[model samples]
Target: EAGVAQSPRYKIIEKRQSVAFWCNPISGHATLYWYQQILGQGPKLLIQFQNNGVVDDSQLPKDRFSAERLKGVDSTLKIQPAKLEDSAVYLCASSTRQTEQYFGPGTRLTVT
Candidate 1:
């Protein structure tokens, strides 16, 4: 009966520094997603996972970003050598088959 959980609700880092965000999806949910939202823009799906396998990652910046779902339960997203453009809110969402998604409180990253 719990929603997704994300760590370090806010982060501040210098450009080029690395950062990682964690997410724990709701129980019994089979789909998990990671999204990025910049100011004034809607959230963009970065990666999606069905269980522990990747379903889509076309929008993910592979050169600087990576994500993984562990044992079909939890996930982590990492951005290495972060850019100023990477400053945004990272959102985690999960859903069961044929159902609406539940979102986390998100991690807000500030690149200075």
Candidate 2:
């Protein structure tokens, strides 16, 4: 099976700038998620979507981060006015039911 795909493998931006990342989950998956993995830390769930409906976004910084899964297949995550702390690896994952998730090669963001 094809794995998840993400674009812009890496990015560098100044603090307060905005950036967007894209993801295409494995076909047929119904659940998608966005996570932030900082250096030396495990990935933290930022948002979740179940067939285009948001399931969870409690950990997402609403002030600067927004995400959407359109038509239940593709997803986009955007961060505006990014802070230095926002520099991290942004991961996209998908799963069926409650089973294991398949992760994409994450987008590494560097904020200077």
Q: Which candidate comes out best when scored by TM-score?
A: 2
lDDT of 1 at 51: 96
lDDT of 2 by residue, 15-112 (tens): 99999999999999999999999999999999999999999999999999999887889999999999999999999999997678999999999999
lDDT of each: 0.96, 0.96
Residue-pair clashes per candidate:
0, 0
Worst 10 residues of 1 by lDDT: 94-103
Give the local distance difference test score of model 1.
Answer: 0.96
Model 1 TM-score is 0.97
Residue-level lDDT of model 1, residues 13-111, one tens digit each, is 999999999999999999999999999999999999999999999999999999999899999999998999999999999999737889999999999
TM-score of every model versus the real structure: 0.97, 0.98
